[model samples]
Target: MSKKVAVLVAGSWGTALASVLAANQLDVIMWTRGEDQATEINNKHTNQRFLPDAELSPRIQATTDMAKAVEGASAVLIVAPSSAMRSVAHQLKAHYKPEMLIIHATKGFETESLNRMSTVISEELECEEGRVVVLSGPSHAEEVVKRCPTTVVVASLDKASAEAAQGLFMNAYFRVYTNRDMIGVELAGAFKNIIALGAGMSDGLNFGDNAKAALLTRGLAEITRIGVEMGANPLTFSGLAGIGDLVVTATSQHSRNWRAGSLLGKGQKLDDVLNSMGMVVEGIRTTQAAHFISQKYGVQMPIADQLYHVLFQERQPRDAVEALMGRDPKTEMEVMTLETWEQWHS
Candidate 1:
């Protein structure tokens, strides 16, 4: 029998990943909340709403039942939106087995508790937190489903599980890498969206390459600063999940966060921008979470601070940009304190 994998939810990213698994000749089952979506995928092998141009593989199956999706599966990949992660994980509780390789491709944090997606999964599943793996990088769903060459990282505290996940997803078009710094990977993945939104807003404001480049550069610096403070390995931020994701999300038109930020920069209201996107722009919510995280940790995140104001407080996008530019002059290389340098190097 072929290796069996269960993918939760039928979002664009989930469907795209299922397609990858099907390409690997795995017996893949996808669970969706909507009966219509499941029926459509089962019959038409197409997820029109999410991936309109791509046709799915016949090897991939869809079901509305969560238990049916995970039953006898070797691995369960949870791809629910961050906002619904807790509820989705809870639904899997009765069907989830301890031995199953649990992996999540979801990005962003739980707003209420400010917990990472892996933490949320472990809490709901009652499994060791180290057992959960996070798959993330610059790969976009639209491109991935098209078999466009893409690379991603899977990180976990358990090296064996990380390698297992890497083996399952690696392919000719989709490359997978393993990292032991799960915290750094998850943080980099979650935090980059905020900078992407900022980049889009910069573009929408008609700021040229110079402004956007500065945002990307300083954005990575602040992100690394916070990630290191949160017990993440500093070097991880310089890798795929870090600068790699930031560059793609910040520059690509395919990024929903970037699109959302563009609208905001063009003077659209937050509610209007979100209502228009028709998808969960993770950066919007992640911005809110980052606001709280920055306050809690007392880390200075100027870009995130400006974004929080622009998105929530009705600060004009231009004004936000002005505030960022008008800040007191400071050295660019002072991101990490001497203490952090010693801890990381020593």
Candidate 2:
């Protein structure tokens, strides 16, 4: 008999991961709220709206019933948008089993609570936080479904849980790495979205490579600063979850955050850009969350602060740029990592 896996909310990333599990010979059950989407996946094996031109594996199925989706599954993967994570996880609370491995691939903070996805899930489930694994890295759902070579990291405070998640997802085409730094992994994953939005806005403004490159560099610095302040390994930001994800999200056309930023840079209103995308742009909400997070941590997140203003305060994109440029000059060596780099260079 094949192993069973449950995936919450059949979005692009969720469906792509389900296909991976199906290919691994697991009975993958995807739970979605939409009757039409569930029917499309159950009968036609195609999720045209999300994964156009791709065929889902025969072993995969979709259902509107949450209980049916997770019932008797060995693992559950939550891929809902950050905004819906809490509610979905709460609905999942009734069906959640202690023995089942829990993993989440969503990459954003809860805007109102300023809590991470895992925290929200743990709060909803009333379980220890360490058991939940986070899946993140440079992997894009678009490329992953095509079986294009992809690598991702799974992290949990519990080593066994991380390894279990790794075993479930790793295969010939999809590679998985394990990390013990759950906080760092989660923080790096969420914070990078804010920078991607900035990078996209830069592109939309017709700023050439020079300007965009500078923005990415500074953006990484901002990410590192916050991650370090929040007890994340500074080196984690340099790893896949940090620099790798940041580079991909900030530059790639496949990145919804970068695309949303690009539209905003072209002087589109936040509402207009969001309406046009027709998909959840996690970075926008993250920027809003980060605005408060920065205050909580007492860390200065200049780029994220600018994005918060641009997305919510009606500040013009160019003006935000000017403000960033006009800020008081300070040596970048304020952080121990940069000072250490300076030491190495000297």
Total clashes in model 2, counting residue pairs 3 or more apart in sequence or in different chains = 3
For model 2, residues 1-346, the per-residue Cα lDDT tens digits are 2299999989999999998998888999999999999999989999999989899997889999999999999999999999999999999999998898999999999988899999999999999999999999998899999999988899999999999999999999999999998998999999889999998999999988999898888888887778777777777888889888998899999999999999999988888998999999999899999999999988888899988998899999999999999999877666556554553346
Any residue pairs clashing in model 2, and if so which? 200-261, 200-262, 201-261
Give the runs in model 1 whose Cα sits over 4 Å from its true position: none
* Model 1 TM-score (2 dp): 0.99
lDDT of 1 by residue, 188-272 (tens): 9999999999999999999999999999999999999999889999999999999999999999999999999988888889899
TM-score of each: 0.99, 0.96
Note the Cα lDDT for every prediction shown: 0.94, 0.91
Candidate 2: stretches off by over 4 Å? 335-346
Ten residues in a row with the worst lDDT in model 1? 328-337
Query: Candidate 2: what lDDT?
Result: 0.91
